[model samples]
Target: MKFQTFKVCGLVFAFLIGSAFLGSSGSALASQKVPISFNDYHGYTGTVKYIKSVAKAYPNITKLIEIGKSNMGRPIYVLVISNMKTGTTIDTFVKLRNKRKEGVKNVPPMKPYQGKPGHWICGSTHGNEYTGTEVCLYTIDKLVSGYGSDKEVTRLVDGQTFYVCPVVNPDGLYNSIEKGISQRQNSMKKDDDGDGKVNEDGYDDLNGDGHITWFRYKDPKGRYVIDDVDPRLMVRLRRNAKTDKQLYSVIREDRDNDGDGERGEDSERGIDLNRNFPEGWWKTDGMAGGRGNYPTSAPEIHAIAEFFTNNTNILMAQNYHTSGGFTYRPMGTAPPNQLHPKDVAIFDMIMGKKYLEIIGEEVPEAWKAPGSLARFKEELEKKSKNKYAIARGYELPRGWRASYNEARDRRYGYGMASDWMYMQFGAYAITTELWNPQKDIKDFPQFTGPDARIEAQRALLKYQDEKYGGKLFIPWKKFEHPELGEGEIGGWIPKYRSNALPGEPLLNVCEKHWQFELFRAGLQPEIVITDAKARVLYTANKANSAVVSQKGDLVSIKKGKSKGKYKIVEVTAVIENKGKLATHVARGAQLAGNREDIVWLIGDRDKITHLQGTKFQKLGVIEGTQKIPGYTGRPGAGPAEQRRMQRMPRFIPPGYPMFFRMRGARLEPTQVKQTGPKREVRWLIAVEGNTPLKVVVTSQKGGTKVKNLLIQ
Candidate 1:
């Protein structure tokens, strides 16, 4: 295939000139089991069907779960992709002591995939931002189809789990894509105009053209003027700007359906689902800050919140949006100071670096040379006015930034999903605004200066003209409006403008994001029981209770005689985190309903008796194999800055002596030392009749692993 770029009417355009391959390539097509096409958008119905097909086709690696339903009763789904037979949870191995007599079926059973580390990927939180839906579907196709074919994909599917929700707002997505009306919020039954009826006056296809496009009419007070380069494109004049061209008023191809004198004011448009989360939904003035009556008030958001609450294994999450082609990490509702130093390094140095590289953005110098962050911080202090930037050592890159308005010191919005996921759920959550025409499209000319937007619009119009045969745009046609009088009805189809142009451009955006997510998935903490051993120290025909007494430097245990055979066994197990990141964020375990990593010794309840260590021990946190670049905090670091400096690494600096005394006193370093991810746990137990022993390690996000011990 050959492609060329040329200048046309002050705009650079590229089109498919020719191709070497005459027919479709076997490898290019989707899996034979579930075929998908990116040439067009797949609304709610298509998405449901495709996911159902995938779940049916790949039963071993996929399970379709309906997390919740939308206001319109559409099922919101999450497809779990993992080796279903391979994982286990703590709840499964540990039996509950008491059972309630009342039949209350509130808690659902945990799935096998929930036992493994989880990466959540959801799209279409906003109905009109359906580009996210396609990206999610593309990611799903990549995961499912590449499972057996790609090595990395196979490992991820086998070890980790992916919960991909294609459409978070089903009614909004369906109305936008299927009904050809740009509905950005979820659907509701409330009457917006309060005309004693629900959903009475919405967008109506006045011209009966199937699409609810724009209707333009000449008006002296209108803010828009016909573009000189591309007459079809509407150019909005700058505020208070004088324009000689005829000003026009543009509105959706709609009218007053219920004779309310208002146009589409009482439509099914509901609360913004993204703003219906539980975090920062309340204002300081004791008022409702976000959409709906309260946080998680909308059915969609409530479902999501409930799902995250139940599924604690998810450590990484992504909420996809469109147009900006950038990612927003957490703390959107607060300033940068709220984030922990360790988490900041992980989100920026590791994940943000990879994201910038994937999107072809320059990484910050501080990120590249994290060891010299202090120097960078000094340099930034002199030149940068942003306090957060000066403190952090570098300004956030354009491609990766927080939604918090740092310059003005204001929150971006209330009740955002990513903020909730990070602050409360303890996940490395982010919201990625996908799609940039100049970046995603090959040979798409860069536009700049005052006329940049108009020039880009012109170029895109021409590009679509050549590539899509002008099918995406509806040509302006004369039409008589019911109330607004004479006008022309036409414009770029609503879905095609804000979203990535389907086919090649959409595929490009999807691939880059998928690659970035794959890298992130590889970073999830993987806890494994590397070694387990059981050795019998003593055996007796009958025993009752054992008592231990210590004298001077010696300890002895005395056993009482009983009518049962007993063998005292020493069990030791080595648990290690083999992945690239820690099991939890700095404050993850400290959050409500979360706990530190734990290791348990399991056997028959009545047959085994713990003699030394408890049945389970809390492993503070199992760090990952990979070292964080810019982070210097050690295990004993305190919350206060002064205390953190006091508890530095145990190893002395080059100029310092191994042992040092302060103020004439011989102050020795603490004897207790905390090491790396590996932890060796031991338990002494009395086993009767050679009962089987098992060692289990469970981390909320690091995953669960169990090993059987052989008593020798």
Candidate 2:
């Protein structure tokens, strides 16, 4: 689809333009220019009408497919951009293949049979992960407009199809936008703090500065004190290094609206999207971080899950977040010993290498998490015997220099997304923390990079403050709280503080990360036709009557070197498949299948069955090994038995790799090797062929390369 390039504009101007374009089209659209400024990024509200605006602008290329609806009745629009023809669905290809399988050989090839794998990009599963939404929108704009123009972009798009959902949590995202609050939960309105009442009271704009910031008050028993090193930052008071008995504490508003003493004692939401995943989902109250009674409780999460279930062609996945600098990979809850050695090695290579190039740091090994998408991927591989390498949780650095503890925002937990993906899908999955607030500091080393701009954050903050009338920030002010009467409530706004960098610098950061994401998409698992040919073997007939019929089905006899030529099938074909798993868990009657339909086959003249090799299984099989029609059925379960199968653990033998896809990065299989002294460290390397391609190496000592090999 063609996208109109938008010129940069103020947030207010951008909102007006975007709103005006909503659900309208025709000659009036000719003069419309989309504003591409930082304000424009934040102004997006994910409205259905706004989707129509995007559609109208790129009528030829943009398509609004309603994958599902959110809990608040918001349509989950999937904006698909590709040069491939429409009305060409994966179903169509499947149906055609079934028809071909039913016919005999020596028949004309299925009329115009053409099929291609696809790639997926999703955003905003967490309500507070807003940067991903903007970055995704920007990516859509770039891809649609740059198609047939930009060489790299064009190659990526044309060679592979793209499915993008700008906002996975429409209700949460829109609610927060409307309320001007940075709420991480969905719109279920439960008691989060668990004081009493449901969402009765949350962090308020006590200072009226359009932000929820830390509020420190003077108390005789306070435990915090300003750090002598940096007053701008906070530090825990040392036990023996105090003079006065003054006490300090960070406080927000009370939860109960009726001035009740209880805080958010009764305000809890339905579930945390990240924790709702099926893998390692514990039944504890806070196990899944507010995961509802069961998986897929929220409509938004369900919709996302359904989309991934249907689109099995997707092999690579990427989910964007913010507030951290590290890139993490799967096996979240699994102990280091339980982690697949090969998978760990691969993750270290891809993530470690990328981190060094982008953030100039090495990803740390060994972190634990549960109920994550990474675990789901691991389960998928175990269930389907498909080697789907999925990665989740790309965490951006919370503190730019790693020494700022308060700056460590969990909003961008790298280990969460990366580890989940590696466990679920054999393909790649990554969660990139889009922006870092520390990067906004003028003297930050990142500003000196090739893509850096002078005082970018200052320019963005100035623009946002002026355009929004400071409604997007928190100005210093005092308020009378029931808990702490007469205390200053002003600190840092959600978007203006330590969580996110200034929008202007953030845009550049997003662009650079998006480039890396594009590179990641290129690394998704692909299939190639290494060889194809037919050969005839002659054997001696049981009875040497005359010359035995060489064409006999069994015991055919053709003595004395028969004059026959063998056709050597040789062609190089790259198969690109990007997959996505919407939510980690399934809800209601629907269970996201453990296997995606990424398979390849080579058949003979009979055509009754074809040799099959899939991303899940490294080995290939001859046709007719199984009686299943499309090879879509689960192993050990017959067609009739599969219908009655419940959501229980199923065993899958080795050689078959299962796959799953989600919002974030794509993952692929890699071999792991332990080298160096004591073999205490392990490295992950990508496997291209029989040969091993070194990606990462680890050691007891910290350094760049190990024995000439990079150890990122």
Candidate 3:
């Protein structure tokens, strides 16, 4: 089938002739299982090469485009997969995104996916966190290959357009693959030890085993000891333990290069692309986790930030990571318990449900609830019948344990990507930690004590032995260290646990995470103006309120009998949100400065506009909190969107950019006090002519709608 492009229209013309596509080819309809050739998530030259081949093979459905390059000149490729719905969805979004950053005016925000809304999945940022990259590749393959072959796949691809950036940190991933899996930061070398040297002394395969494993040497003043039952594992010494035998000291597999007597402390200094985002960015010099001198200082992360912040059409976003079967959100660096109590409760409850459906994990509802501790007590008594109600004051529940250190409830992260995307932009952003070995075990033991770690080790080892013939773990062996003398340099290899999931279980992990991603896409806000109704003001009295001559999208009213030659008439349009979340989310509404949620009237009206530096005459915004109006809202008094948009899900300190769309010269977007759950906003205007009225309603979060009402 052939398609026609839409000509750009000025104010009053609402219709944007959507793009169209031909039906699938006969052979393209052949459905088959994802070829292991492309299905494997572990390593197939990364997503860099895979997307190109997929797009080439399926040109009608997939478009391979590069947004920018990484710090090391690696192309940052994005695959826009659509079902011939291409001309409208992908290009419009890309244009809007590009122009928004440039503060382009007169360009309308991209419409919702013509047939379905759009979704963005950021595969990976930390090079070593290979799970997200794998999942992204697997997902892209599923989409392009499964189209027309699988019913669900056909529905998804045909309905929704996907922007998949499989690997966000190309330099870092290549570094890990080329040097060692332990290479966590990207290739932007820095002076980690602040000694005015870069990449001077970092990890080395001290034993020349082609890997970077830890080293433990026998020493009289050591704080660790080799597990007697599992000599391959080492545990720190417990306090008050009586022992006479020589203990051991553990250090990373490296040698001191700066003569500082420290090993691996100043090696391969680079920014952790994940921690270099503007949100929660650490400004102090020499911060940990590869945080660069400034937020988005790295080329890769800055390009990504610039891309997504401008692309407001993104409904859901996920930054994939591996190990520890955990799903995390914003506030990675700050204390988790300090977020808005209600927001925390809602995130936990809603995210918990998704987790159970996807990874079979629990989000621990016993954590913290909304309202104060006193409110919790009162509700507990009323609901729990005072039997199991808490008699003491509220205490924050013991949070999750860190996989590497087994440290509990540790709160620390700065400049994490997920927090920026979600907290600032208000898009549903999730950083997924894939593969928790505990999920595969029955009676999972805790990592509380040395003995407990040994038991946990035993469980994992036994499982690995039974499952993969013990091929995953690198057996402990004695080796000679250059500076530390004789020691053991064997433990769980990077692939064995911390980094990517082993090749065997990777498929299952990808499948589950993909399902969760689809679930999120299903929840994206779909804006609708089907419920919009227009009325013309007729008359008013002390008892009889202002009336309209007729109702509908368009109605013409003549000058009324008010003893005057001409009389003004009011035209009110009611726009309703019919999606799950508010038109724009609660968080997005707060950060959307100047880019308020409202309906636009394009006609011969003078002085109306949202842009500040443009040359073209513009329409005026009526002004409200979230909309454009003149009422300070108080709960049930003002428009629903305004009441909700002003709230901050979490109060982050100043410094980070609010990633909102739309180009407005206002100091900030309107502060919305309310978001939604089936709400309506009324657009009221006064006009004199009987021309066609094209109204565009956009809820920064909900989809956009253009309705034409001809008035005569």
Candidate 4:
């Protein structure tokens, strides 16, 4: 119930120490509907419970979806946060041609939230790296809790869609936390050859302490020595360091359960989920560069791929990992040249700069002076051997970097989710390694130099002792190993060792990442029908009685020779992208299954005939109002370039095919195009009687919006 205030880099942070921070409602004492605590880690069971509660408590804004199942048959859940009734899609208005009487269920109906721009955030791709799970849960708590109480949150919840998948690898999280086994990869039930001869030499709690901690024994060839400052900690020695201290061999608190004389040989561990995506999965040598026989071979990765396939509205994607407290943008498999310069600007100068600031890291000098990039690029070309770095004008900072090994000029890994999402799906995707004890922990001592890791470990032990009463660590105790003569069974608990320490430290990590994602969400493109009106240029009892022609601002109508009840109406609509980023990234529309933003004029199809513009007009990519920092490249394609049409073939009367073709009138479709953040579209149509009209704008990644047109 007590609140404490502190400052990090002059920005004051207020957090509740003993209990979880109650989400916003009115006052500090207001009870949170779905109260959540970061006091300790929430494994799969707890996470599922909390998310389900949020979905039930906030039914209007939240829907819990089981996207798919893991290898262990555990459901992978994605909690969607958005107003369920506020949005609409192009499918609702546009009628398709050649519809079949018996419908095939190839594609499911688009949900209302799909009509809005989507931001996807998932955590725990690796089982042992479950710190991201806590952050994901924390983000969900902030969003659902702050919905009606906070202004910015309210606007976001009402306007945009947020897909939060708290646990991408459910079995890994369960095993890591609940079973106390540090499983980095997901769990698989099958063996290598599917012969049911699964290896069972997984880590066993030999000490019966209910924790799969480390066991250390004396050995001349041991690679670890007791820390001078903290005896409870064991520090690893350098490969060739000659230390005069007693050496110790350390292993997980496990024994040969199957009497195979080997430990953890064939555990339930599956392939690395991050290395199971579809981008750069095959090497140039025709070898499988990624894990598994092919991309998405793992069940967990398959679910993620399928979910992304169905949700094309997602433009911003984040896959969370642990321990490093840094971010990896995209193109990890390829070089920086693979990314468009404009995207690079947005990723580095915009998102990267903000991330470094949030984590209290120094922003690169070149990033601050984006206008001086030309000079920086020149400087890099002369001094740096990394061509990608030279092209980007600066090397990526430690806090925000690509996983690709730029120094060695080599790929980091294959089938990375971020690379797949960006190159193939055209999303602004990134993988953020969450938690850094040095940065996230308030007032933790700064460790540097050769022995900095040992020093940091000592500080963390002391901090946990003072703050958490030392329960976080298990004191080393001598135990008689069933196989070895003697050893001590103790060390930091598996999950607590590498992840963000519980309570304030974990909360701090969660807050910083939530803020970053919130900022990213704010950048999603928002398409809107700003202004729309239908003007009745001419009206007559019969369609042939009125033919319309425009000269300057004046319109003249004369008797014509077409058919029926006619009213020549001119519909003008102003479409704009009011959000921060453009409707799509560079070349995003050209990606398969993606298209340029389109505006549709809807009415009774049978009654209205388009005399000028088509019923639906391609708006191309509607530029956003926000200017991208550090990017001076050409903007996205404007309406004029996007709406270009081929010349219509001259129409020839049916009966007099060749002889009378010269006397026949030539006909062509009319189109009006404009550019930039806004477009003015005009359509001349003949309406039979007084047909109601509406204008709808649809963008694959931007969002869909509609405005009813009133005929005057």
Write down the RMSD of candidate 4 (Cα, Å).
7.8
Q: What lDDT tens digits, residue by residue, belong to model 3 across residues 1-712?
A: 1222333342224432221112343334453233434222344254656677677778778777677777667888888877765323333322243453333532334433433456788765777777777788778877777787667777667656688988787777765655654556767566778888887877777778787767888988888877777666676777867576669998767788788888767755476787788766753465544377788888888777777765665656788877677777555654443233333433444544566646664433333332254565665566553232243112222222211111243445678877777666656666777766565344555466646556766777777777677766777778888787898887766645665345546667777777777666555555555554445543223121233465677675555333222112333344544444443343344454424455555545442222221211111121212221111222321222343555636777698678855564445432323343333344344443344455565544454556666542
Q: What's the lDDT for candidate 1?
A: 0.87
Listed in order, each prediction's TM-score against the native is 0.89, 0.57, 0.68, 0.88
**Quality of model 2 by C-alpha lDDT:** 0.45
For model 4 the local lDDT of residue 290 reads 95
Please give, for residues 1-712, the per-residue lDDT of candidate 4 as tens digits. Answer: 1232334422433344212344432432242479999999999999999999999988999999998899889999999999987988777787545332334433566778999999999999998888899999998888887877677888998999999999999999999999999888888875643435784667899878788898999999999999887888888988899999999999998777666577677678888998999988989697999987699999889888888887889999999999788999987887666777788888999899999999999999999999998999999999999888988899999999998888788889899999999888889999999989999999889978998888888898899889988887899999998887698988788889999998999999999999999999988888888889999999887556467888999999898766666788999988888898988877687666678888889999978989888888888788888887778766654322343322335675678656443444544333336667898999999898877898998898888888888888
- Superior candidate under lDDT, 1 versus 4: 1
C-alpha RMSD values across all candidates: 10.0, 17.3, 13.2, 7.8
Tell me the whole-model lDDT of each prediction, alpha carbons only.
Answer: 0.87, 0.45, 0.58, 0.85
- Rank the candidate models, highest TM-score first: 1, 4, 3, 2
Alpha carbon lDDT at 49, candidate 3: 62
- Cα miss at 519, model 2 (Å)? 0.7
Query: Which numbered prediction scores highest in lDDT against the true structure?
Result: 1
TM-score of 2: 0.57
- Per-residue CA lDDT of model 1 for 367-475, tens digit only, reads 9999999999999899988899888899999999999988788888888999899988889999999998989999999999988888988999999999999999999
| CA deviation > 4 Å runs, candidate 1 | 1-32, 97-106, 546-563, 634-675
Residue pairs with clashing backbones, model 4: 543-564
User: How well does candidate 4 match the true structure in TM-score terms?
Assistant: 0.88
